[model samples]
Target: MSTDSFDPVLLEILGNKFASVTEEMCLTLQRTGRTLYVKETADFACALAGRDGRFFAYPRSIGVSGFVGLECLPAIEAAVAACGALEPGDVILTNDPYRSTGLATHLPDLHMIEPYFDGGEIVAYGWCFVHCSDVGGRVASSISPVNTEIFQEGLRIPPVKLMRRGEMSPEVKLFLDANSRTPEANMGDIRAMLASLATGRRRVAQMLSQHGAAELGAAQGALMDYAAGKAEAVLRTVPEGSYRFADYLDDDAASRLPVRLAVTVTIGGGKVHLDFTGSDPQVATAMNIPSCGRPHAWLTLRMLALVQTLDRSAPLNAGLLRPLSIYTPPGSLVNPEEPAATGVRHAAAIRVNDILNGAFGLALPSVLPAAASGTVIPIVMSEPLASGGRMVQVIEPLIGGTGARQGHDGVDGRDSGISNLANNPVETVEAELGVEVLRYGLRPDSGGAGQWRGGCGMELSFRILSPGSHVLGRGMERLLFRPWGQAGGQPGLPGSLVVNEGQPRERRLGKIDVLEVEAGDIVTFRTPGAGGWGNPLDREAEAVLVDVEAGFVTPDHAKAAYGVALIDGRIDAETTARLRAAQTGSEGTVFGPERDAWDSIFAPEAMDRLNAALLALPLSRRQARRREIFETVLADLPSAFPKSPANAAQAEAAQRRLETCLAETS
Candidate 1:
């Protein structure tokens, strides 16, 4: 290891300093960034990459929904090719996910790469990215599930020199200014990213002064190797075997059909191979992954993480990926082809997590936790008030319970498969908009029944105190298939939202737009519950009693979900014993964890193949491409197919019209 070639102690200190420098850089960006997703939501990331483009050190947790996959090498190389040479003061910007690989998924995700210089030579580069508010497109928010092509999604900027020498480029500036719906917000985010780059430059210089440039370079490579070693050790712990998992995309938004992803994970002798051979082809929609057949690290970080979690000693680094191999056939969802709208890749990724869980469960059933609530629907509802025109607002970001582990019941009302973002406070929601939050708490009967009952879901209801308003609900999934349970557990409830004028016959709206309504319209949203662990009757009476007092479970649900009867606030010990001993009926059969189901489907190779097939379809036939693929898969699942064929056929026809309209402009 180059780390050993140098002074180990010095390299360790330099490594610590490198991490500190990048962290401080992120802190600075958050303080200065303009958008709410930045300043409020904290969706951003900053890191110091070695001159080689690989991150020597990256944040463990911070910023943006999913950016651990982003890299600066390609963008930097592109800039050098364009400008002939990159000076000390130059910085590059690119949001083209296809060009940057895992770097930037969509246009709003602005990435900046700056070269760090030392003694007239380049040492490293600092990088940062944020999902800006807009980049000029068909919608107010630059991202939309309806976008069939990248062009409709937003302006695509390949890796380009945004700065030259010491000044911002005039052409870059003019182009950016013209292409954004929210130009001011985009510029604010860019400035924040640029500031982070400057921070990387400064801290890198400090590390060089202490450890010397050569040692710093050596440490970067060594650290990566060390991480790989740790990951391998972790892989060795899992019982060597091949595991299969599968998951689904609720829909491509343009079609009612659900997309399927299947993966088979082969892990043995410290190696992991992800195969996506039978997975469906790519879609015409933007909800695709742009991996280009290459096994991008971001695509498989969770698998690595699951291994690391099982083996706590495993180090985080690119080396961890060495033992991991992926097979993503072109024209699939996990690896999309040219111009397949990929505005929302995370939607597909969420399912990928499930597939890995299933495969891991097959290999190490006792070690891993059960499936989570299985979906994250941050439902944003907007409306207009009496004195002012209506605007959009997030009523609440709905989240489900966490999956139950072997020894513990799943956590209620908290899970972060995507971004472990904190839910907005109900008080904050009420204060910012004309709404009164009525119910914001756990869903009592929603968790799947099991030995250890599944965690309860949540229900949030509010009244629009003002008049006309609009609602935009993104990231909504698992509304049909309830969150599954594990062992002998039950499934959680699906979520729903309805608007009414104080009557039972209210209205349920799908992906909404501007709406007119009076002051008394009430909206309620319910999130799913987590799966359970073990058998319901086997659960200890004390645990059942505790739940009764917690209000998360009631006496009726206790008996129904767990077969534990309550007597005077205490479990009827004698009756419980009798009931427990008599446990029977189809009600007792556990649904198992959803992680078991989703994990079964979205294995690494499965995603690779799925994405590759999606990418193989030429840009022109993307909509029809996505529909046929998802429709075929959904046809098999009677209980699971979200898109009714009749409607999907209609939407597929409509998507072509929309794609044609977009093509004429593109």
Candidate 2:
């Protein structure tokens, strides 16, 4: 092997070594973490940043891939400014989105940065973050959609030094302990974060020892270039042009009103640009994405996995973003300004992924897949069984279907568009809390009707064996906009929740808060289904008959949705012929008109521009700006907020807000 180009085998070897280092760091944190989200679900990320503050190696399939572009430079700089000197035992803590320039979007997510030294000189930093239990302040859980100001949410730690030259800071510890609902759990998570930093520091130190400081630094640069090359190659494969896609949030959690996301993806040669020009402005709610107009956690996701997973050896760095650009106007949902409450940025990110998928599908028609179940639902239950004794039970984070890619039908009842977390076992929930698991199975025939039918969602039911319990479920997406299908495939069913003794009083609950339940209260949760892949009528006769026999489609729905008549588990010849004849003229996706209306106004150009406008306004005015934008579009429509099953009164009220905002913006 020549030194001029270096051996390809050696490059592969060093790449895998760095990859293992990050993976091991994750394992260490997971082993020590106390929270179920960390220990069980794995909603965390770990990475190694170069001296310049950009990550060189990020885990591809583990943790949240969107956080790969986070810069530790800001937090490091803040620590140096606040604490005069640094030592080996020192670690910095921060979750102030504005201070970190959007790196730590929410309060519950604690971010820590540690500097690693080589020959007495600081060479690089190791960074990690985990979603902890609580941080005290306003709400009982510390995070709610209603929290507009940072002071109301929880403790906002600037880059205060958590560890000073390797010793724990008592002052910082005191503040943390005083401000959290579960101080012990928070502290355990903190220790986990510290452990993560130490792991990264050790790994970096090891690489430095073996390769020498200069060679390690050189490797970082080389790896970044390599990622850029691989990413560009993927870009070139996407036929040079533009593709657009849009999705929505059910509501801001404060009202019945929905939020929209529209994206326009432009690809030329090897570079891609994501323009979120027409999305709603940042709202008062916590769902804003604090991007700072660069490739933020929310924006970098599509490219991160697309490049790295396509080539596992691609450098785990922002260099993948080197050949890509994001155009999110400041103050929009994707790029909110300072003091904008961003506790739920991932809520917006799920929509962003859908948008990217839609756009990419247009360019790479054969390569891309249809829409998925498109939501992450965590069935949270808090029970105080015996008089005043409290226990929290997370049944499981219920997810829906994965999209059907070319040459394959979509997978049933599983998705990872956001953080690909695992579902909690029924046994685990029952073992820990005051509840008995009733049902943990798939919802039969809940998927949309199509030639290449979408995947079905899930149904989870449980009985509160003890009294005085509080039940909460959140992170639910695709409840408003049914996950759309491509190339004439039909959309899927929306989700719902019911509470009762399996009777008519089993209410279709809206997105909920803590609900008090007594002994014998039976609760059932039905997740949404995935989108279909092709024209339903074009579906095979045998497939339709199978759907009927399997209880996936009713005899009536088989005739309507698939345009087939299945009598005695066999398709009627005349009906099949008519269905085929009717397919000659139909084109475009088959999502309902309600979804179409939502998608139109919240287009990519509109969203990017709206967010940019929001960024200019003070943080206090973000909600007002967003509400106004949506209201303006709905003012002229007959059924305002089309996604909702609206009546005249609701439409009038929606129009009032829209008309008022439109007039003001004008």
RMSD for each of the candidates: 6.6, 4.0
**How many clashes (backbone N, Cα, C below 3 Å) per candidate?**
67, 24
At residue 398, give the lDDT of candidate 2: 83
Which residues of candidate 1, in runs, are more than 4 Å off?
A: 1-8, 64-84, 380-397, 427-436, 465-468, 501-505, 509-520, 585-666
Per-residue lDDT of candidate 1, residues 1-666 (tens digit): 355465656656666676687778888898888765676667678877766676767665566423353332244454335445678898888888777665677777787888889888888878788776667676655666667778887788887889888699988999998887567667877888887888778777877787677777888887767767777888888788777766666566665555677788998898889987656666666678777676664467567667667666543445567778899867677877777777767667666776677667777766655667766665555454355522444455577787675677777887766566556677777777677888889887677656666777777787768655545555566665556556666667666667773588588754433345567777777777877766666777788788878887778878766678887887687777777677663332244333334333333453444445545556556546555444444344434322222244643554444344333323
How big is the positional error of residue 564 in model 2, measured in Å on the Cα after superposition? 5.1
Model 1 alpha-carbon miss at residue 5, Å = 3.3
Candidate 2 overall lDDT versus native: 0.72
Error of 1 at 40 (Å): 2.5
Give a tens-digit lDDT track for model 2, residues 1-666: 223364566666667777787888888888998777678777778877776667777676566654533342244354445555566777878877777766677887888878788867777777788877667656545566556756777899887788887889899999998887677777887898888888888887888788777666666777777778888987777679887777778788787677777788988989988888778777777778877776775676766657655676566676777887778866677877667777657667777877787778787766566777777766666665354434443568788877665556677777766567777666767777678888887777667666678888888888887766777675666666787777777788888778884587566676765566778888888888887776777778787777778776778877777777766777788977786677542356556666765545444444555555655667667676666576565666555356544556755565456445544654
Q: What is the TM-score of each candidate against the true structure?
A: 0.84, 0.87
Instruction: State in Å the error of residue 190, model 1.
Output: 2.4
